[model samples]
Every structure is written in C-alpha cells, then in structure tokens.
Target chain A: MIRFDRVSKRYPPGVDALSDISFEVAEREMVLVSGHSGAGKSTLLKLIAAVEKSTGGAVLVGGQNVSGLARAALPYLRRRIGMVFQDQKLLFDRNAFENVMLPLSITGFPRREAAQRVRAALDKVGLSSREKALPVMLSGGEQQRLAIARAVVGRPKLLLADEPTAHLDADTAADVARIFKEFNHVGVTVLIATYAGDLFPGARRLQLEHGKLLP
Target chain B: MTAWLAQHGDAVRLAMRRLASAPVNSLLYLLAIGVALALPAGGQMLLANALSLAGTTSAVPHISVFMAANADRGMAAEIESRLKKRGDIKRVQFLPREETLARMKANPGLRDVIEALAANPFPDAFVLAVADERPEAMERLAVELRQLPRVEHVQLDSAWVRRLDALLQLGRTAVLVLGVLLSAGLIAISFSIIRMQVLTHRTEIEVSGLLGATDGFIRRPFLYYGLLLGLGGGIVAWLLVGAAALWLRAPLGELVRLYDLTLVLQTPGTRDSALLLAFAAGLGWLGAIISLQQHLRKS
Candidate 1:
C-alpha cells in the first residue's frame, strides 16, 4: 500500500539522496529493495514511513500523501507501518520483553492483552526464553529478532526494514529473513532493504543504482 | 473516564518507578524544594505572631483633651459640653485638677512628690472614649480637639499602636515577596531535574516517539515526576515549619510570659497546609510542562 510518484529527496550542499524514484508495492506484497551503501534505499523507506518528506515528488502510503501529512497525523501513518533501523535501536536499559511491548503500550493496548501479544511475538522471534534479558545481554542476532518483534507487535500493515540483518552471520541472517518471510506470508506488506537480495528468495526485487530505479 | 483514569494511573506508576530509580538524587532535590518553601512559611508564621502581640499589648485607644492653665472654670465647662455634643465621642469624663492631684497622691511613692509641688500642676482634662477604635478615626478626632479654644494639647494615645501596625504590614509584604521568590526557585529546580531525567531517558523517549507515541504520552511520566518531587518537597517543608514552630513554642511562651504579653504563635492551620501542597504540585506540573516542551521538540 505504498506508491512513490517520482519521489526525490535532496539534502543541502547539492546532495541528492534519492532522485525521481517511482514504484508501488501492492497490499500483502513481499518485495526487496536491493542497493549498495548510500544508494538511497533507507531514504525511500523513510519517505514511505513519513520519517522524512519527499523534497520533489509526492510519496503516498495507504493512499495518503506522505509529504502533506500533518504533524498530528504522522503518528497514525507510522502506526500503520513498522520500521526497523540498521542500528536495532533497542532500549539497552530494559529487558527484551519491554522492548517488544513498547509499541503495544504506545497504542494503549490492555496490559493483559499486551503482555499476551508480546509473549506471542517474542515467541515467533524465538526470544521467549530471553524475555527477561536486556539488549546488552542478547547477541546480535537475538537483538535483531527483538527489534522485529517490537516492530511487528502492533501488527502494522507495512513493514519497512533497513539493513536488519546487516551484522549477522549468514545462518542468523537467513533466520531473520525467514522471520520476515513468515510475517509477509500472513498478508503483511513487507519491503526489506538489503544488499543481499539473494537472501530473500522468490520475492520481487527492486534494484537501485545512485537512487534511480533499475529495470 | 475509566480509560482516562487508567492512563493517568499508569503514568503515575511509571513516574514513581523513574523517581525510585535514583532515590538519592530525588531526595536531594526534594529537600531543596522543602527548604526553599519553608523559609517564607516560617517568616509568615513569625509575622503573624508579631501582629497578634501588637494587637494585645497596645493600650485601649483614647483621646486626652488637656485644657490650658489660664482657662476658667466656665471655659472647661463649655469645652466638656461641646465634646459631649460630638457624635464621635461616645463618652466624656472630666478630670478636675484637684481630683487629678488627689489621685496621684494616693500612689505609694508619689504622695511626697505631689505635696512638694506648690499647687496642683495637673490641668483640667477630658478623657474622650471615641465611637471607633480605628487609628484614622482617632487621629481625626485628635485633630478636631486641637482646634478647640481652651484645649492646650490633644493626645491620640494609639500612636505606638499605629506604628506597630505599620511595621507588621511591612513584615507581611516582605514575607509575600520571599514566598514568590522561593516559588520561582522551586519551579526552576524542578525544571532542571526534569531536564536531566529527559536526557537520561532520551533513547526510550525517542523510540517511543518513533513507535507513534503521542506527545502527551511521552510527556505524562515526566510531568508526574515533577509533580511528585514538588509534592514531596511540600510535605518536607510543612513538617519542617511545624517542627520549628513546636520547638519555638516553649521559648516563645517564656519570653511572652516575661513581658506579660498575651500572645502565642499561631501555627499554620489546615488551609495553610493545603495551600502549600497545592503550590508545590502546581509548580512541579508547570516545570514538567516547560521541560517537556523544550526537550520533546528536540527529540
């Protein structure tokens, strides 16, 4: 449920992070945005998530213009879309369960239901036993899994992951990729940005070079 | 309404947890707020006592109209009749020179002193009890009596009472200014503490923001933190002022007994305690709102 009408993101000092990129990912479609470092994959996802506005053309998520969305409306837009940053962005002070429960809490889910859903999500990510362990206590793969649980706990329709498996070993990356595939299989629109498009088999690939979409 | 209560309850719980995370720091901040509030409160209490003492110790106000030495008996009679006609004078008692001398002679040691005088030195006087005890009204009556033909001097005996009232008024204003300054200081201290807490929880806050948390959601716990600190400080201040008042009660009672003055310290009552708590909570909430506006904008 995302469409970009020739979206372009330009930074100061004449730097173009993304230029004239247009694409669409239909509902429940699993896609991979393959790009090298600084190829504007993150910018594209950020534009869809409404984290960063498109400078030139319009970006639409859920049929609404992301560029024109009011500040008060950004939260609703973000609530519909789950985001995973490359750095994991897990709270080091809290245990794994709290990190996963954050999004549910933000949405004001009942505590009992929220705990149940958090447990289910953590279970899906194979983090059930480590629920009480802090992020510092988890391995890189487990932290990535924790982030995925947090992002998906709200059951966002669209999942935007930026280099989610960046620092993982091949097997762990495969495991993480499998988790994404599982969510996508359940009718969630998933667009993953990664250099290893080969990791996500049978998914539509949108390759980018210098922010321009390649056929 | 249920949901609103639940939300606030959750926020308060979280705030308590956050405050409990750093017990020592919270206690110190609370103590600072308490001491700041206590200073003005103590000042106000002492001033109240001073005012009450002034009220009791001052003599009953009266106006003394003294007739000139050369004035005749007819002039004295006419003056007394004129004073009795005025509505301002509720009662007028004439004291003849012979009676004034005889009363002085009755005093134990003053008998010899009065006999040494060749003649009665006391002049004919009228002691006028005025209708109003107000200082202004008494002063006005004294002014009117001075203009009487045979009246040599008019004494408004409430002059020292008026001066004490003025001094007490000045003290009340000083206490008010001190209270205002301390309130500002309390707010500033809470603001600083909230700012530090925001810094400490920066990542959690940012993550929550990213997860579509509303600004109100993000600000709720911090506001509660400020409010709790302020409230704790208020309680400490109340206890401190109460204890100090208790400690001073004995000493103050002894001092008043020595002076034969009917005055006692009026400790802060329920209304005062309630006001102190309300003020602390208000300042804490305000500080939290300010800090949240600043730091949340950055996030």
Candidate 2:
C-alpha cells in the first residue's frame, strides 16, 4: 500500500514539483498518473520510493512513512518498491538476463531462485529468448520490455513506472500494458505515469494540472 | 548480512571481472604499485645489515682495572682472584710489577730507562672481559669490578659501542623518513587516479542513482577498483624490491665478509608483506571514498 498525505516538494528557486498532494494506491489497484511533462509525475514516484525528500507532509508505503524513514532503512524500503524507468538504463557490459536479474540480486535472492524468477519475468515481457542479448543488440521495444522485466523480477509489492511506454510503438505499448495488467492481476500494485495517450486502457486515471492533483 | 552482501556483491565481482577482461591494463597498474612499495623495503634491508656490522665488529666489550700505587703484588693478585671468581667476569689477565718491568724490559726505547731506574715504578693492573654483550651491562659490570681493596680505578671499553649505537640510530631514522614519505606519495597517487575515474564516469553513475540504486551499491565497484589497484601495486613493489635485493645480495654479503662481519639482509618478512598488502588496499579504499563524497550525491 502507498499513501501520500498533503505531500509538497518545493525547489530552492520557488518552483513546486508536487503541491499539497494526497493519494493512495491499494493492494492490487492499477492507477495511471496522467500528467504532462512537469506535473510532478516523476516526483510523486520518487516520493513513494524515498528517492527524494519531501519539503512538507508525508509519503507512506507499507505503513512506513518514507518521509520519516531512517537513512539506513532507505535501501530496504527501496527493495520493496520496484521502479521502471522510461530509459532502459541497462548496464552495457551486462546481458539482458543479467540486467533483468539486477533487482533480485541487489535484494539478495538466491541464485537459482533469481534465475527462475528472471526467466519468468522475461517470459512475461516476451523477452524469454533474448535474455542473453545485450541492450545494444535489442530493439527499443525489446529494451523497454527488459526494463519492465527487471522491475518485476524481484516481485516488488509496489510497481512504479515513469513513462515506461515512451519509446514503444502503439502495438508494442499495448503489449507492455497487458504485461502490467497481468502483474496487477497477480496482486502487485501498479502505478504508471504516462503522457502517452490511449496507452493503458480501463485504468483509474489521476490527472495532474501544474503541481495540483486534478479532482 | 548474507542478503546485504549478496545484493552488493555484484559491484565487487563486476570490478574484478573488468580487470580480467583488460589484462594488460591491470598489469600496468600492478607494475606501478610494486615499484612504489620496493623503495622502503630495500631501505629496511640496508639498515638491518648496517646494524649487525656496526654492533659486532666495531664494539668488543672490555673492562680495565687499575691497582693503587701502595698496593703490593700480593694484594693485586688477591684482587685478580676476586675478579676471576665473579660470574659476570668472562676472563682476566694480570700484569704484576715484575711482569710490567719485563714488558718494559722488552721495549727497545724504554730498555735503557728501565735498567737505570731505582724503583719498579709501575703498579699492578688487571684487564677484564665481560660476559655481557651490550654496552649498558658491560658498564655496570665494570663499575662493580672496581670495588675491590687496592683496585684504584676502572674503565669500560665503550667508546666504540657509543659510536656504533649512534650510527645505527641514524640509519634507522633515515629509513623511517624515507618509508613514510614514499607511502604518502603512493596514497596521493591512488587518490588522484580514482578521482579522475569518478569524474569520467560521472554521467553513468548519475544514471545508476536515478534508477533506484542505493548510494552503497554505486560505491561498491569503485571500492573494488581502488583495492585491486592498491594490491596490484603492492605486489609489483614487492617484486621490484626482491629483484633488487637479489641482485645485490651476493655482492653485499661478500663486502660484509671483508669487514669480518656476518651481516645479512632480511627479506621483507611475512609481517611486512602483509602490512604492505593492507596498506595498498587501505589507500585505494580511501581514494574511492573521497571520490564518492565528491560525486554520487545526485544518483
């Protein structure tokens, strides 16, 4: 579970990324954060993940106030919430399988279990056969799918996607959306931030205008 | 603990893997590290040799006992007996008046004067050898030996001992200064090199940070990189110092034998080698930590 209670992030130069935001995602909800470029989409995801500090108010995930989490516990907190970047962010030196296995490995999964889970996640993203291929060898859509596999491989309780469908075609975007839907169906909470219209259908949409959440 | 290490192990493993992938570069760094370590190691070998040579050959412990002018030959002989029975005394030789006159009798320049003298004109004396090898012990034994009736004076043969001790002390100081300066230079070199790498890889590190990698996860590989470089450097330094010692070992051994000394150079002992390895790793770790502080805040 993820909750934000009147969370506001103001930069030093008087720019507010997220202003007085209050929202929550339940156990298996698929919530689309629909906003244009600077509607605090990434900031909101960062707050939930404890990647950035909030200026005022609190962001809670799994009953731990991330705003109040100790620095030492931040890593453990991050281990539970998976984040998929718009960019693949794959290590060029590593193959697709290794890339997908990064999260599980970082979170201390056993090798055999990590391999099995990585295989399953890659299969879900339609990258089962290309696990050994490097990011440079994979197409844009394949790389984006690899990113999704990496995020989901650890079986995080919360999945936060920041424009994960950016580089894919309409057909490929729909395919990725189905992968997200399948993950949500399996009881993983999914919150996707997207400016890509008609990408994820039948999802509860929360719009953001400027720094304020649209009612 | 197992889980944390399992998560972070990739950074260390990857760093080493990269080294294996670039064998030539790795060798180059190793060579640099080795050269840095050899200097003080060789200095240590030099000082060890210099000390044994100076201590044994230069200073031979000896004590001198003088008799009172009024002391008769019988009383001086009694004193000699007392000195000989002491456990600290190694050996004693006495010069009685008649023997002293005889020794003067043998001197060609003093023979005329000795024959013309109305008196024996010489008090009896004893020379002592102390069982103690060190200067301080020999001095104490000499003072105690002079306490006999008719023993008017005592001398500890310690002039050469003092000189050698000073020389040895000076040599050690030089070695210490050289070692410290060299170690500091190597650490600085490592720090700058790692800093350069951090600057070059700035964008890559930033990306890793933004993608939810923890600060420590990003720091892990760099730590390995620092450690490997330092260790490789230390090994190189060890080899270089060993080769130089080997090259000079026979010639130096022969030169020492010419001085009638059994001086030997110590190979950098196990303790020294271990310290060098640890030193290398510590220096590298410090450098990487510096780089982390300067960067990695964003990611």
Candidate 3:
C-alpha cells in the first residue's frame, strides 16, 4: 500500500521533478502510473522506495512515513519492496541463476531454500532454461525476464517496475505485462510506471504530465 | 547461527575468487608487504639474539680491588678474607704481587717491559664477582671497596657491558620506529588496493545496494580480501626472516667466535610471528573499512 500527500520534489537549480502529487493505492491493488518521459513517474517510484527524499509533503508506504525514515533503516524498507528498473540492472558478469539469487543472498536466505525459490521464480518468468546463460548472452526479452525473476524471487509484498517493457518487441512486451498481471492476480500489489499505458489495459491509470498528475 | 556463518562463508569465498582472478597482481602486493614487514621483524630478531648473547657472556659483574704498592701479603690476605665474607660478593680470588708480576711477564708484549723493572712494581689485588650486575649497584660496591684499609683503588669492570646494553637499547628503539612507519605504508597499500577493487566493482556495488544489501553485506567481501592479503604477506615476511636468519647463522657464528662469544642467530618465536600476522591482518581490515566508508557514503 502507498499514499502520497501533496508530495513535491525539486532538483537543484530549481527544476521540479514532481509537483503537488496526491495519490493512494490500496493493498493488493495493481496500479499503472502513466507518464511521458521526465513526467515524474520514476521520481514517484523512487519516493515510495525511499531511494530519494521528498522535498515537501509526506510519502507513506504501509502506513509508515518513508519521507522521515533514517538512512540506516532504508535497507530494511527496501527489502520489503522489489524493484525492476528500466535498465534491467542485471549484473552481466553472472549467469541468470546467480542474478536471480542475489536478492535471496542479500536477505541471507538458506542456500537450499534460496536455490529452490530462484528456480521457481525463473520458471515463472519463462527463464528457467537460460538460468546458466549470462545476461550478455541472452536476448533482450530474456534479460528483462531475468530481472523480473530477480525482483520477485524474494517474495516482496509490493513490486515497483519502471518501463519494464521498454525497447522490447510487441509480443515480448505483452508477455512481460502478462507476468506482472499474474503476480497481481496472486495478491502481490504492483505499481508499474510506463508511457505505453495500452500494454496494461483496464488497470487503474494515474497519468502525469509536466510533473503534475492528471485527474 | 548457521545462516550467519553461511553468509560469512560466502563472503570469504567471493573474496578468494576475486583474489584468484588477479593472481600476479595479488602476489606482487603480497611481496611488497612482505619485504616491508621483514625489515623490522628481522632487525628485532637480531637484536634479541644480541641481547641474549650479552646476558650469557657477562652474567656476573666484576670489581677489581688493588692494594697499595707498600701493602704486604699479610694486608692482602686480610683484605681478601674480608671480601670473601661479604654476602654480596659471590667469589674473590687474591693475586699476590709476585703472582701478578709473573703473569704479566708471560705476555710477550709485556714480558720485555716487565724484565726491565728491577723490582716487582705490581700491587696485591683481589678480583670479586658480585651478585648484582646493575651499574648503580656495581658503582656502590666499588665505592665501598675503595674505602677498605690498604686498598689503593677499586675499578668497576662493567663499563663495556653498560655500553653494549645502551647500544642494544638504541637498536630496539630504531627497530620500533621502523616498524611503525612500515606499518603505515602497509596500511596505505591495502587502502589503495581496496579502493581500486571498489572502483572496479562500482556497478556491482550499486546494484547490490539497490537490491536490499546492507552496508555490512557490501563491505564484507572487501574486508575479507584485505584480511587475506595481510595474512599472506605476514606468512611471506615470516618465511623471509627465517631464511635470512638461517643464511646469516654461520657468518654470525664465525664473527662471534673472534670475541669468544657463542652467539646464535635466532628466528622470530611463535608468539611474535603470530602477533605480526595478526597486526598485519588488523591493518588490512582497517584500510578496507576506511576505503568503504569514503565510497559507500557517497553512494
């Protein structure tokens, strides 16, 4: 669950990334934050994740004010929410399985259990066969799938994805969208930020333009 | 507990793998640390052996009490008896004027000079071995002996011992200063190595941080790397010092033989070796921590 109350973010030299944004998403709800490039979609996601602090107003996740959270406490908060970046952020040096295993490793999951969970997540993302292949060796779609597997492997309650289907084929994008839907169907709350709102039809859309949210 | 150990085990394995990836570079770094640490460690070993030799060669200090030239054998006997009765004096040997003259005449260089003298000019004397070898104690004993009747002078025969002790003390201090400076150099080397490693793995570190990795988790592998490097260097240093000691033993033995001293060149003992390794490892860990703090704070 996430709530933003009149949140505003300003970069140095007086550039506004997000302005007077107020929104709320209930638990187990999958919401699409539709925005053009530089429309504050990424900034909103970052605020919820506490990756960056809000310049003004309160940003709450799971009834906790993340805007005021201490830096030392950020890691614990992040562990509860999985993030899939636009760039994939998959370590190219490691194989697909190791990439997916990273989150479990961070949490110190038991080796046997972590391996099983990683395999299952890979299977869910249709990356089970390419688990041993490095990211550079994999196709673009497969890399995105590997990143998704890594994000979901830890079984985080809330999932945040930024442009998850960017630079992919139409069919591949549909497949990626289907995986997010499947996760939401299983009661995992998901927030996806994308310019291509058509990929996620029928989902509640919060559109943003020029750092301001549209009604 | 098992999970904690598993995490640490994973970190250590990762560190080892990273080190193995660059074997030549790692070996060169280890050699640098080894040579630096060996300098002071080897000096300390030699100094210790020298001190031990000095102690063994002069275990007891001696004092010479010379009787007046006019004093007779009866006065010499009385003074020797008095010295032998003292608890502080371990042993006293009386040298009569005739015996002294005859002993001096036996020396080739002194024989011609002694034969020129018409009469026995040497005085009766007593050589005393004292229990306390401290300079102050020896001086006090000499002053006491000089006050005896028929005694012309008392000489404390430990000036050379005191000089050797002072020189050895200076050597120890020099070694200590060298060790401290070299330790700083070792720490700087570790810091630079870790800094480069962190920069090389910058992307990986950022990804790890984003994936809910704690600072400790990110720092664990680098710390282990530093610790391993230091430990390996310590091993190399210990070997180098040991080998040097072995190589120098025969030469040192010949040199000491000239002075009638059975000095042995000794390698560092087990406890000292362990301490060196531990100290090196600690420095490596400290370097890693400092480097991580600088970069991790920026992230």
- Best lDDT goes to which candidate? 3
Model 3: what TM-score for its first chain? 0.99
Candidate 2: TM-score of chain A is: 0.96
Task: Show how many residue pairs clash in every candidate, following the order shown.
Answer: 0, 4, 0
Candidate 2: how large is its RMSD? 4.7
DockQ: the better of candidates 1 and 2: 1
Worst 10 residues of 1 chain B by lDDT: B51-60
Candidates sorted on TM-score, descending: 3, 1, 2
Better of 1 and 3 by TM-score: 3
Runs in model 3 deviating more than 4 A are: B84-91, B97-122
Best by DockQ: 3
Q: Proportion of native contacts in model 1?
A: 0.63
- For residues B104-216, write the lDDT of model 1, one tens digit per residue: 99997999988998878889998888999998888877887899997899998888777877888899899999999999998889888999999999888888878898888
TM-score of every candidate's chain A: 0.98, 0.96, 0.99
lDDT of 3: 0.91
TM-score of chain B, per candidate?
A: 0.89, 0.72, 0.90
lDDT of 2 by residue, B76-171 (tens): 778877887889888998877788899988999999998998888778888777787687788777767667787888877776678778877887
Docking class of 3: medium
Q: What tens digits encode model 1's per-residue C-alpha lDDT throughout A12-114?
A: 8889999998889999999999888989899888888878888999888888998998888888888888888888889987899989988877777888888
